[model samples]
Every structure is written in C-alpha cells, then in structure tokens.
Target: MKKRYFIWFLTGFLMLNCSCNDWLDVNPRTEMKEEDMYQSEKGFKNVMNGIYIQLASKDLYGKNTSYYFPDLLAGYWYKTNNSTENYIMSYLYSNSYVENVIKTIWSKYYTVIAHINDLLENLDKTDVHFTNGNKELLYGEAYGLRAFLHLDVLRLFGPVPVGASDGTNAIPYVTELTRDPSKLVSVTYGEVKRMILEDLDRAEKYLAADPFMLGSMYDLNNPGGNGVNYTPDDDWHYYRQTHFNIYAVDATRARFYQWIGDKTQAEIYAKKVVGVKNTDETDKFVLATNSSYTSSEKGALVMASEHVFAVNCSDLQDIINGVMITSSSSRPKLYLQNAWISSVYENPESDNRSKGGRYFQTDGSYAYYLKYYESGTIAATDMVPLIRLAEMYLILIENSTLTEAREYFEIFRQARGMDFAISIGDETARKNQVEKEYRKDFWGEGQMFYYYKRQNKTSWSIPQSVTIPENGFVIPKPKGQSAFE
Candidate 1:
C-alpha cells in the first residue's frame, strides 16, 4: 500500500507581528505582502521570531517531543489510565494516535525549517540597512536554528549512534527552500554529521562578531565599538543569552562530537562552555541553587541563569502543568513511574532534587514534573532550556579521567545538596555514576532517551517489569516522506 504525508509550507502572503516582551509572540496577518514583510529590520525580526514561535508549538518542542512522549519512551513516567498517553507509554508505534503524533512532530519541525529557508532566501533582496554585526547575527541565528532542527530530526528518526558510521542513511540536511520533491533525498550518516558541523562552524564565526558577545564594550560610545547607534529599547544585547549564543553553538558541537564518539573534541568544546580551565570566570554559567528549583515564587524553575539557550515561552508552565494530574481525581493521569523514582532518588531528604527540586505528591502516589512549572502570569522571562550548563558538566565527566570525573561529578552533586564524598573506583564506575546523575538531573527535560540512544542501549527498565525493545530506540518516520524511505 502507498502512503502519503502532508508537508506544510509557509504561504508567500502571510505577515507576522513581533512583540517586544517576547519575540516569539508572533501573530499572523494575511494582508501584508511577502516583500513588505522583509522591507525593514523590524519585519526581518518578526520573521525570525515567527520561526521560534512555530517551534514552540504543541507538536514540536512545546510538548510531545520534548516532554510528554519522549519521557514515556525513556521510562521516566508511565500511564495511570488507558488513554492515548497510555498507548504512547506502551510504545505502540502502530497505534493511529501515536503515529499521528509522530507525524505531526516530523511535519511541524519541517514547517519551521521551511519558514527559516524563506527568510534566508529573501534577506538579501530587501532594502533594509542593518549594521554588519546585526546582519551577521541574523544570518548566524538562522543557520544555527536550521542546523538545530535538522539534527533533532535525525536523532528522532535516524540510525543508532555508532561512531561516525558511514553506512547508514540519515535524514536529508535541508539547506535551501525548495518545493521540488525530487531534490529531497537521505544523506549518509557521516554526511549529515559533517553538514551539521559545517553549519555550526559558520554560526560560531558569525556569532563571534555579534555585538551582544562583546559584554560592556557593545555600547556605541565605548572604545573599539561598531559605531552602531543604540538606545535602551533598541538594545538587543540582553536578549543574546536566550538566543543561539556563541556558547550554545559550542555546547551543541560538544553534544554532536560526543554522539559521534570523538571524546577529545567533545571535552574541548564542553570545557569551553563550563569554563573549566578558568573557574573564576565560570560565573556566566553556574549550577542552579536549591532555592532556584524549590522557590514558591512564580516561574522559579526556568533556571534563567543556568540556561545556555532556551525557548522564551510564557505559557511553558501552563503547558507542563496541564499534562500533570493536578488532583487525585484527575483523569487521563500521568506521573513519574515508581520504579524510576526508587532507582534514581532513593533519599528524597538528602537529594535536593527530590526534596523540592521536582514536585512529589504528599502521599507519594505521584511526583509531578515541575521543572517547567511557573506559578504566575506568563512573561518573557519564562523559558524552556534547550542547552544548559549542567549538561556540559555531564559531558565533561563522561570524557574525563576517573579522578577528574569524580571531581566534576562531586561539584554537581554538592551543588544539588547531595553527599559529595561518595568514592569512585574506576573509569567505568565513574561513567556509570555520570549516567545515574543524568537520569536525575534531566528528569523532565527530555535528555535521558537520547542518552540511551547515543550508547545504543537495547532495553530500558520500566516500572512493570518490562523492557523496551531495541526497535523502541528509533521512532518510525512519517509515512509520506519517500525520500527518507
């Protein structure tokens, strides 16, 4: 039987309005012509903002792929009822609902990619005058976003990681805007890795020239300035950390290198992000304090200071809390699996992550994922971290010596209020310790499954004495993408 998939495209006439508080607050308008939309800097900004907004939709990073389904696959959570979520938790890939969700993830990500391509294709045709730095920043973010999405697509659908293996075919690395279906074809796994790295290389070069990275010297009157006029409102400097900053590009490179089994490059890039060689200068990225996670204040768990790059979504908390069972009577329930809870967080009192880090019901029947939970009105400050400092530390420990690994591991453990004196035996034991910490550190943030996939693990331990099959590691590709087939 022949299968068909729907590929979404950005219509040429649609225009988007940008919001100052949250750039991702883009509302669509059909009246503005495509040419007019890119005629000014504000228009270009709106276009870029639209890509982020689209990416944060429910099908993409907003829920399914990032938190809900992937967590189920990771065996971190389980279904309390026989709902669609239960089917997902059971790894019923053939279920129509599950298949549709996977397809939406595939289609929606490409939709964002298509819009990015549209923006890049038309950027030069517009007459808007941008500073050299601003121009580079715009292009850099566009390229970086494209690479980021493509890499995730490969992670979800491509072959298991096997040390830069060139034999397996992977998802197409889309670069240009194209309606020509004939041009879409899967590339070798090695080719996709190289393409992603090449894009990151360009992103790093362009982003280094960005004024936002210049710290205090970005002001116009300062010495060695770009001479670009700036005002408080026009200052894009503060927003730099939220976007694909230079450090985030490096963090992404570290992750990619580690996945491809290049521990040397991985350690180098990971060190750059963590500032390991320069402890005094490491204040830019630090571990979140116990209070940051347990505070009663609204939007406390966004961990704004620690995030290397995150999505600015005001409704992030609402989205996460909505998936949770707010009350005992709530139907279609979802909660952390008891097995995972016992395995990782045996001592809730000593482990700050269990005490107030991730919320647990008073009765212990359920533990709500509270990492994205914000208690008040959604604002620009609310964010979902895509890359953060803690993960960098994990990367470093994974590639370091046993003694060195223990040192790094203790730093993270102590930061979380755990006992720091835990002894380590050897390199293998140190690596196992790192993996255990990963399960606890990134519980609801969607890193565990990828961690297992990178290691090519065949089974995932679950609550009900079940083991996830090797096929479970790879989600099925959307049916209509013949190129990937």
Candidate 2:
C-alpha cells in the first residue's frame, strides 16, 4: 500500500489581477511547465497537486461562484452589487455578477482541467510502474473531473431558448479553452448537453464506483488528522475528490442529465446514490438543529445524508463550507436557500417526524432557517450539501408516477421526518407536489435554482416569472490560458 493516502506540487503565487502585485508576485512557488512537471511519477503528482490548490482558491471554492451564486439565486434580495446579493438577481434580474461568477468558476475549473489535460497527455506515455488499477483511478478521476467542470460551466451559464427565438441564439460549447484565432463559436443548448453527457458517459465506467472507499477504509484516515509524506491518495486527494473523482460528481452527472430533461438516465444515477450519505462525523462536520442538536437524526441527515451531489464542505475538499453560522459559537456554516426553506416549511405538519428532533434558537428569527444550522449546537462546521436524500428521490418522483416514483422516494421522506402517505391527486398535482417537495427539502443547496428554472415545464420559475434572455445565458470565460486554449 502507498505510505500515505491519495494524490501532487506547489505554484505558490496566485497571479491574479484581483490581488496586489506585491502579494501575488512575492510568493511564486516553483514555476514549472506541464512537460517538465509530469516527467516522473513524483512530477505528475506535483502537477496534480497544483490542481487541488486551484480548486480551493478564493475565486472558485474559497469565495467565488459556488459560494456567491447560490445565495444570489435563492436568498434575501438586494442590488446586483449589494454586498450580500445572493442568487436572486442572476435568476430574476439581468445582471453581471452571475456572469462574473460564471466566468471565474469557468476559469478555476479549467485551470484544474488543464492539469488533467496535461496529465492525460503525459500519463499515457509513461512506462507502467504501478498497477493498472491505480492508473485507471488516475485517468478515471481526470475524465470525471473534466466532465463535471464542463457540465457546471455550461449548466449555469449555458443558454436554453425555450422557444424558436433562439434560431439566432447560440449556446456555445467550450470543450477546450479558446485562444488562438480569437474567434468564438456557439452551439445550442441541446448540442452542448449532448457533449456534456458524452463526457459523463466516459466517466461512469472509468471512475470508481465508491468515493468514500478511501474515507471509509484505512486507506484514507489518519489518527489525529496528521500524516504527511503521503502517497497517491493524500498527495492529491483534494484533486481526486474535490475536482473529479468525488462521489457527488456521479450524482452531479445525474443532475446534469435531469436539467436537459433526461429522466431515465437521471433515475439511473440517482438510484446509485440514493440514501448513501456522508455523515458529519465521517466527513468531520457539524450538524446543528435546535433542541436535538447533533443528537437529532434529522439534523444529522440535513448535514450530509445520502442526499445526492453536495460539494464536500471541508478543507479536505477545498475551502470551508461558508462563514461560521452567525451565532456565539462561530461554528462552520452552510448556506440554505429560500426555495429550500419555503418547500420544507410548506410541508404539512403531520409530514415531518423529526421536527421534534431538531434544534431551535431561542432568538426569534424564522423557526425554519436557524434550527438546523445554529452555531450553538453541533458546532464544528458543516459542509454545503449541494444534494441530499430528500431531493434525489423527489426528482425521481417528479419524473415518475405516484406508484413507481413513490417506491424510491419514500426512503427520502422518512429520512426528512415526513410520514409517508401517498397523496392522491390528479397526475399533474401529484407531480407538482413532488417538485415542490424537492424545492422545499433542497432550498439553498445551490442546484435548485437551475432545476426550478428548467422545471419551467412544471412550475419551476424564479421568485418571479422573468423570462431569462438568451443573450443573458452565457457566462463569459474566466481569465487564463489553458491547454484547451
């Protein structure tokens, strides 16, 4: 076995126009090119290491798109430039932050992707010294990460013309980063989804079936979380899990499919991850609901249950989940969106069994938002749950009938403290309720706003039914040149 766990090197300088030149230029870690970096196994590891550092960078995970956009789309509203503007404007108004965030997110992801592209180019040429299993693991993760990065870039920023007005519209695909001739090419939404799915399809097989394999077994763990001089896993573990090879990416693929209206594939991937969750203890996070605190199973499930597709909220993954929950404890924080709050709040009283099992702040805010995440309770820190039990099956049900869908969905309902009773209704009403349940259960999870917008087929509108302009759909590329470029 490798001495340490997982995967990689250092390029210390941030090289950002956003930062002062004094700070960024002073700390340039060893500057190396892809050819020089990946010459040996250790060299390849170095290149991969840079990829993880990029993932955790402020522009991407630390403080950029994923962190900012969700709040803008779902939370309390403010001006587009308001210090606390969340996801509302991008979804509701025609604004630039959304574009900026998308651009930054794209930039960060491709930086990681360029490393993968470089690794893929070089690794294939290296002599086989390690087991094929290890080699597959490396390339598999590279592909999966590449696929996911592309999907996210396209998902939030890519345009879908609801009507024929898009004949003049373009939903461009950026398979490789663009540079040379400086000309831009655009593809429609349907065409981009096709390519996105193809990347994911390659990942499904090349990627590992289990993400927590390292986390679940001795392969990943350390006694006091102190083990350096790592092997394949830890050296580049963040790149592996945070970027491409993560468990959540599988479900992310499902989500990407669902966004483009592919139910059968969505259900296939969802079933793979349904009810398989990473607990706070396992992932090293805190789950706080009022009275129940960590003791409440409801609180536990809220933090990291088998819910699908969450960005792992740990230094282990990238950046912290969010700011500390705004309370005395100053614990790690996770943002929950309004759509999620409303859906969970709207559930019938009889539905939630774990309601009694959660925490509540004595201070009178809304009982809904603070109860689960109050810093006063399980106060280590919580990761952002990009996906979860309740929403996974709920999506399945929305695409299914009362019987077929209910079989898969009840597991989530039970987990959410909902008592299962098939609400009889017209087909449309039942499906609508399923969609609503997903909305409530998944508020502020990040992906919901897009789902709601897509569910325009159902009632998935932003806070208001503003028609998203086709021109507004593109999130401009971030600043940098990559192998793709």
Candidate 3:
C-alpha cells in the first residue's frame, strides 16, 4: 500500500505558501519519515488534502466518476452508432475498451483507498500535533471520505439492490493499512453497507465541532458571539463545503439508506439535513435561486450555494477546455442531444435549469454541460459537486407520504424556477415526477446512472428508450485476484 499510494510530503516553504482556500491544493512529493512529517500540523493536513487531490484525478471523480464515463453509461451523451461511446451506452462490459476502462477504475479506486488507510492508521498517534479541534476534523473528513468512496464503488460494482440477498458477496471493504494482499477479504453487500454506516457514525461524532455546524458564526468576517476572533489558526477550517463536513456525512447516510431499500432511514437522515439552519436562522445551504445561476460572472454554474460537499479541482479549466467542451471539428464530446435536453427540461424557456439557462451552452445540434464551466474569477466555480441540498428534497419526495412528497418537491421545483405545484396521484406518480427532476437537476454530475440503477429500471432512456439487460446495470469487477481483491 505504501509503495503504491502517493507519498505525502511538503517542504517548509510549501507549508508557508498554503492559504485557507488552497490548503488542500498542495501535491505530495519527496520521501520523508512518517514520524518526521507527522510531527507538524501541516504534514497531517497535506496528507488529507493529498487524498482529495488524487480523487480528482481523471481515473476517479475528476473525469470517469464525475461527468464523463458515468454519464455515457446512463445514456446522457449523444453517441454515434457503433462507436465506443455507443457500445458503452449499450452496456457492453465485455468490449475490450469498456473492460479496460472498468479495470482502470477498479485499480485506481483501491489505490486511493490505500492512501486513505495510511492517514487513518497514523491519525491517533499524531493527535498532539493538531490544535483548535483540527485533529477531529481530519478524522471526520478521512472517515467520511472512506465511506463516500466505498459506497460509490458498491453502487457501481455491487449487485442491483432490488432483489439481491444481503448475504451475497459484494466487494471488499478494505480497512487495513497493510500491503500484504492476503490480509484483504471480501464481505457480503450487507456487511459492506454496515461498515459504511459505521464509518459515517465515526465521521459524524468527530465532526460535531465542524465549522459548518456553527452557522453564521463560522465566518471569519463576522466572528459573531462565540467570542472567537478570526486568526490563522482557523484557516483550514473555513472551507467546510469543500471538505466532507457534518452535513455531507448526513447526506451520504441519506443516499446510502435510499440505495439499500430503507426509505424510512433515508427520510430520517435527509430530513435532518433539510432542517439545518445557521445562527441567524438562515439556511446553511439553500437551493440555487434564479440569480444564483444567471449571474453575469457565471461562477455559480455548478450551483455553488447548494453544494453540501464538493471537490475543488484546481485544473478544472483544463478539463473544460480539453475534454468536455464542443469544438468546430467532429470529435465527439459530452454532448447532450438538443432534443433530449428539450425533453428533460420541459419548460426550456422558463426553467432556469434548461438549455437557454445558465447550465448549458448550445452550439449546433447539441449542448455542452456547463456545471463545471470555466469561470475562474470566483474560486467557488472550480468545485466538482458530489452531494448538495437539492438531493435531500428529492430523497424526501421519494420516501415521504404523497402530501409531504408534493410539499418537498414543490419547494425544490420552485427553487429551479418551475412554477405551479405538481399533482401526484399516488406513490408511482410521485416517483415519476422525482425522476424528471433528477434527470434535469443532476445532469453532468454522474448521478443519473445510479438513480436509474437504484430504481431497478427494466428499460431506460438513452433519449430513445431501450431495454437494459440482466447484467447491464452492474459493471463487472476486473478479471480479478479474488472477490477480496
């Protein structure tokens, strides 16, 4: 594990340069003893930040797990017939190209896990180095990240949750810091979910003092009645949204519960997040208002205010320029067919989330996803949104009684600039309404695929609906060493 994971290191000068917003931006390099490095507070921070940096790599959330590959899997992109993208849209796991992509995703996922394990193992010993409750923040972020990654892996590679038995072999829930391959073992899907929740339990406990919980009091500019004056000591604690803060943990719990066919538990966690308020009783995280997305600066394309947790990708502009954007030439892009875009956002002229809206840029026949749009003047624009406030409302819509579902969704709908209330006749109608919101709201976020999988849909819209095969929803684990591997 040590050999494979990025060796986290920071020079004295490098530590001098880190600021509140960019503390997590430093890359790992050089060889140093764990004892020597962990003796300082910055060293621990660099390691935690390094894990996030690696997660933003192309093999992970930076591309494959974010908007690119997963969206293709969900049939969001317009694929030419017989192209590799088309093959993926067809769920052709056995195709050589698709298989290799799967292998890379699997290997990279575990490699990052190895990095996380290293941090978790060394945390307890270095407790003395942290101050101002930073130690607990590190522990909380680490545990929450572990749960987040493992849950995503399970969602992609584990069995479809609709009818699968809990005791079936899912994937290895790796917690060990050891490099010895024999020590790892695969657990049942049920066990995996149990372990994920347990890690989240630790994360929530440790993050009780997280700055995000402080509401308006956490602002350095405001300082508030807590009697805590702003100082350099608080730098690392300021950017709570970019870290896996307390609300993010609850949001993850809500997501995981919904996945496991536990609607009651899902609603409980989702509601907890929905009810959160700040010192002044304002929403800690609110859904994006019309002006939030329509601002001339274009900084809030990813809906910055709503992000419960997001990764700040420093090279986000490079991704936008190189991979996602549309060009004059015929090279395929992450293009949303114009018709499909119109289909999803029924009120394209009125809905703020639509084609002529702030979220997309139309060229000829298709549109470019602008969630990760290039707007670097504001630092918040660089975020790769993972979890946000809107999903909590969507979760409630799925799990709550019909009247409650309508009420929750109406708030969400209004937030997205949709006027008029939905008249959902029954649970099925309510869910169908929720699906439309997910399709429009989560575009380019890599969530639509999971939403379809969780519903265990027999057929899905590749824009034009088609039947999904028995094994289509599951991506095969690499031609592996073992289930444990």
lDDT tens per residue, model 3, 213-308: 764423532334354444335777766787889999999999999999899999999999988987668777778867775465334667777778
Q: Tell me, what's the RMSD of every candidate?
A: 6.0, 8.0, 4.6
Model 2 residue 359 CA deviation (Å) reads 7.8
Indicate the residue-level lDDT of 41 in model 2.
59
| Ordering by lDDT | 3, 1, 2
Candidate 3 ranges with C-alpha deviation above 4 Å:
1-32, 81-83, 217-233, 296-299, 355-357, 375-380, 481-485
TM-score of 1: 0.85
Which wins on lDDT, candidate 1 or candidate 3? 3
Instruction: Sort the candidates on TM-score, descending order.
Output: 3, 1, 2
TM-score of 2: 0.68
Q: Best lDDT goes to which candidate? A: 3
- Per-residue lDDT of model 2, residues 1-485, tens digit only: 11221112222224223223222232333443444454455555545445544554556544454434643453322233443353444443334544455555655655566556656766677773654355565666666666666666665655542442323333344444334333234555566666666766666666664334444312232322443222343333432323355455557766776766777877777665553434323431111223233353333434443333333333522233234134344323343333433344444344442243233222232222332242444442334444454455666776665677666555555545555465635677666667556555553345555654565442234333334443434344433322233
